[model samples]
Target: MTRKQLDTDIVIAGGGLAGATLALALTRAIPALRITVVEAFPLTPDASADTYQPSYDARSTALAWGSRLMFEELDLWGALARHATPIRHIHVSDRGRFGATRLAASDHDQDALGYVVDNRWLGLCLMSALVACPQVTWRAPAQVRGVTNNVRGVAVQVASGEHVTELQAQCVVIADGGRSGLREQLGFRVDSSSYGQHALIANVSTSCDHGFTAYERFTDAGPMALLPHGSGDRAGHDSALVWTLTDDALERILAVTDEERCQQLQQRFGWRLGRFTRIGQCHHYPLTLTTVNEVVRPGIALIGNAAHTLHPVAGQGFNLALRGIMALVEQLQQAQVRGEHLGSLQILRHYQENHRRDCQSTVRFSDSLIQIFGLDIPAMKLARDAGLVGLDLLPGAKRWFARSAMGLGGRRPRFGAVTQEVMDD
Candidate 1:
């Protein structure tokens, strides 16, 4: 109905974690930049809080030590702390097998290993932070129709009802979603492969306290994880269930009623968490591996799920996006000091230069983990169990693996107080 145009240092497409975070980071890194973010869907803003935060949602995220350090610097962890659950310990094992490994907070000499949080809480916190930053002019409830790249910078067109207008900036970042129509339109092709699995997520009740332990069990069909949610009135009501299964098996599970579903889960899961009274409303996600080659093209840079969407098997999809966002911010800051435009090829290339290796490694690692672990061969089972035992046999190796999983083992941001050498590969 109404057409409008604006200007800023950076134009971000999509308001998910990556876009929102990059906008806020750039605003803080470069004062008075006036970042504009175009979001396709309209969302309600909770303006009452001193800090922007939304109510916790049913979908949860696993926050690593590295992610926490970044959030702390952005001043988001404090708001999230109120409702977050610490992952005090992790137990990894094969179903009906003798091979198992346990990692604890005491071993790491930290307060906790990581955290399990509602996705909405983190998104709200990031949104709230963006609103508080005077340098950022938040724009959402708008859709992106076209984009252009030139020497001046990358220009993005936003559609509002019958009218379409453009916003030009030094750089344009695309983070819309996995099925990023905008990304495709930019002539960026993403390599995608199916995992042949679907994940069913829901809040569930168990028989006993989870004691802050997270479970990763490999079954003949797939891997299942029982993560902790905050406690509630019902017995074992504090756990969130993330079950991954083959496509056909998942379809059958979805076809059943809630009662039957709970009965089936109780049989396989046993009474580990206590008696499974019932499962919550179930949601299904078709798992796939997607990666957009060339994160930087023309005046556009792809981030988050738009760049790469991995199987949720390891729960590091968002973590990887956040890490990449941090890498981009650092590179941008370096470019400015060199008197180069933030949107210049040199600056954007610097980002692609530094991150291409790490991004590919992470994506490949996630896909391989799902495939390798999903195989149910008798010999493969022995090998996997042996691998778990081998790691445990060496305390040092086990700790290293734990740190890597927490996103803290490698070269960390200075705020994380980790040395650069560790992550420099």
Candidate 2:
């Protein structure tokens, strides 16, 4: 097991959530298999040098129940719990007309609606687990310039500071992100569309306690979500906002001083929390839907953002990635036990078939929701309002919808995902 850059049974090309999870799962399932993860971004020792940090990062995620189970299996939930906030209630509403729907934790007999955690914190937990997993190897600041598929396996040509080296593996998984450097190189097509909107995310403090209730208000500009932060919130600072709006509107809001922006938030958002007294650094991201042509190839497979990227309206992209990673591990484990070729085209084909339904469904769901709620047409508005009214009439319709938002409604993974955890560990 010695090669300058080669020799590995499984090579994962990205260290993001999906990649890390897949490596861990495979290692646990198949003790004999060796896994290596190549990442471009490494969690630095210095807090300031860290590109992703909990407090300052403008990005956070609404992890689904299924994803929560994945964290538990990887021994990350305990650490994640420290920085997460439970979503006790989700309030969905439209401005002007009183069309709103509320889903409370009580309806589901759960403590909260869902969990929201900072991406940086979650990533850190994952990295920590990776370090302890004996079957896994971590490589970072490495760029994959080429990939060559051979008779035995695939060869990954990496450019680590001008010195090129080849890493061999039976299969290569792409977890680089939505914009993967190796996606096109693997001969797959990707499609994307801008929503003509930008999302401005930041952490804010409020006068009143939100009590774990998250607000998904459909403002005249666009949809804005205010999710609660987990435990360490020290009472006063408890919420984070993901405000999406037209580019022009977003720019106008960003131009003003933080003082004015806080006021605007208060004006449009009302005093639900009295007033947003202070906001952390404001960051912006373009809202768009990116879909890849396929999830699997002969010697390469794509997971997470590399496979399909959707509008953040639902926040299921990352969760979906976790599910895919789980499934891939299951398939590889069975293949290994059966003495089957893990990197064979037939194997990936079957894996793709199992995940295709969930991938397409999630992408379509997010795209459809964005178009549906974003419409201001009179008839569409009437229809949407009527839909909400219908949902309210049904006792648990709102709760069911909330579960779907958690990414727990899709096809069950073969390894089996119960309620949400990996079935039978």
Candidate 3:
């Protein structure tokens, strides 16, 4: 019945990619802020150990330019860049259609559109940086029993090892994931809708080099994305596959052998990447768009998948989450400077309001792409084809689309001089 009590300025639930990244950013922004990150999965001493690490489990993520800037501010990009493959160009096309679009980095006056890094490598880099910070405490392989919002702050019950500890913090940020148990325990309601499709992800090889070109090919079933990656996999595969398919089609695809799967994929994807030679183990995730109606409570806030999860058609899910974190940091910096309560309703509400527009737009953009491009109607097909052609033909339109895809459009949180000054101090 007796438990130890610990107090801190902030408690971040989930030390996955989002949580770890946010923790690093927070320390960089406010070096004096006390923080503790609780992760359900243990940090394996060896990344290659035959064990589970949630952040490292996924295939890969395309880091948008905006995300790159944020990492640069946190001084984590240099390490990340060593393992990242720059996406110099983006090729988008409609299967069996004549219309296509090519977005080159030069067109947008950039050296590269984005970078793709394996999830495992990214996790290692973030965790390594996190452990070096003396201001943060990391509790791994821990279980959160419950959460209670109190008049002054938030109280969390965490069971690590043999003892239960009550962690009291002025603020709690949930970045656990889409199916966050803590979010549910906190009585937050999520509006969720399935896409009736599943994404089959794996590391695959091509006959020829990818040339650091990312491909977005739309087929009858759904969108198939191929992102380039540096050497990592056992077979020396240089690309990550995200092939979306309908429920019926996914069943067939998942049932086939690896060779058969490769053959089928080549048939649908065409000769853009030559032949599909080698493939790693395939993983399937049912696609769904879920968002919490309210991302902020008096003492708690939601970031990453805990706040909203979107379709990967546009590869905006993680990028959107990073943007929201940047916005939240902006608000928190002001609060800290003004000596205001970080867990106050006013501070939480400000973050929610500042992030709402970007979250809604990114989700809508991804969802619309799924609906509009997946249409089988002849008229809809023609319109979609025209849209692609128009985007390629018009310089202004192409530039705008490229910017959005690069995560450069709209209002972005300042992560330059201000961030540097914080690091310097």
- Candidate maximizing lDDT: 3
Off by over 4 Å in 3: 1-6, 46-58, 231-237, 415-425
Off by over 4 Å in 2: 1-6, 42-58, 230-236, 414-425
- lDDT of candidate 1 at residue 298, scale 0 to 100: 62
RMSD to the true structure for each prediction, in A, is 4.6, 3.9, 4.3
lDDT at 87 for candidate 2? 77
Which tens-of-lDDT digit does each residue in 227-320 have in candidate 1? 8777422223467788987788888888999888888887666666777766877888888899877888667788889888887766688888
The TM-score of candidate 3 is 0.92
User: Could you give candidate 3's per-residue lDDT for residues 1-425 as a string of tens digits?
Assistant: 11133378888899999999889989988888889899999877665312433332357899998789888988999888766778888999999998899999887678789888778878888877877799898889986677788866888888898989998878889989989998998789999999988998988888988877889999987899999866422223368889998889989988889899999999999998888987787888999999987999888999999999988888888899999998888888877776777888899898999889888888888899888998899999999999999999998999888988999877887543345454344
* Lowest summed lDDT window (length 10), candidate 3: 48-57
C-alpha RMSD in Å of predicted model 3 compared with the true structure: 4.3
Candidate 1 all-Cα RMSD? 4.6
Better of 1 and 3 by lDDT: 3
Ranking by TM-score: 3, 1, 2
Candidate with the greatest TM-score versus the true structure: 3
- List the candidates' TM-scores in order: 0.91, 0.90, 0.92
Candidate 2 global Cα RMSD: 3.9
